[model samples]
Target: MGGGWIFAVIVVGLIVAALWAFTKGTPTGRQAGSGSGSSDEVAQLRKNLRVKALGNDALVNRLVQAERNRMPGASEAACYKAAIESWERDNR
Candidate 1:
């Protein structure tokens, strides 16, 4: 009976270890950019945008132009609004 209990505990311990290992494992380089499963593209994009907005005039111009292109009626006020929205979304 004691041997059976020891075996059961070992099995449970192995199962838990396997679960932790799988959950904490890193992906391969190709899998990193696959665009759907477990990717960090959105987070990276947000980080890039924030850095650009904070430090680069060229990037800020490009971002503003992109926003204006997407919303033809977007005024300077609208651009500011969109920028604030983007900032809030990322910060939160």
Candidate 2:
């Protein structure tokens, strides 16, 4: 009976520890975009786009313009491409 109690306590402790580790160490932010690409690569791509266009405000405005110009049900990729094009046009 004592051994059983010891085992139960150990199991509970382990469960608590596992739960704490899982929750405490996990990232709490927007997930990275899907694909085989590393997060660093995706972040770098976003950074490059911003740098190429000057800043986030410009990028966002361009995205809004692209959304307005897009057909209904346009893919995100299409919108992003349009935003890049608009940014290039305006910045140039």
Candidate number achieving the greatest lDDT relative to the actual structure = 2
Candidate 1 CA-lDDT value: 0.53
* lDDT: worst 10-residue window of model 1: 24-33
Report the C-alpha lDDT of model 2 over 1-92, residue by residue, as the tens digit. 89999999999999999877643332321134534335563354345456655687665656645665774565444444445556566776
Candidate 1 matches the true fold with a TM-score of 0.35
Model 2 deviation from the true structure expressed as Cα RMSD, one decimal place: 13.2
- Looking at model 2, residue 10 earns an lDDT score of 100
RMSD of each: 13.0, 13.2
TM-score of each: 0.35, 0.36
The number of the candidate with the highest TM-score is 2
Query: How many pairs of residues collide in each model?
Result: 0, 0
lDDT of 1 by residue, 1-92 (tens): 89999999999999999886643333211223333423253333434455636867576666656766778875554553355455446566
Q: Which residue pairs of candidate 1 clash?
A: none
Give the C-alpha miss distance for residue 37 in model 2, angstroms.
12
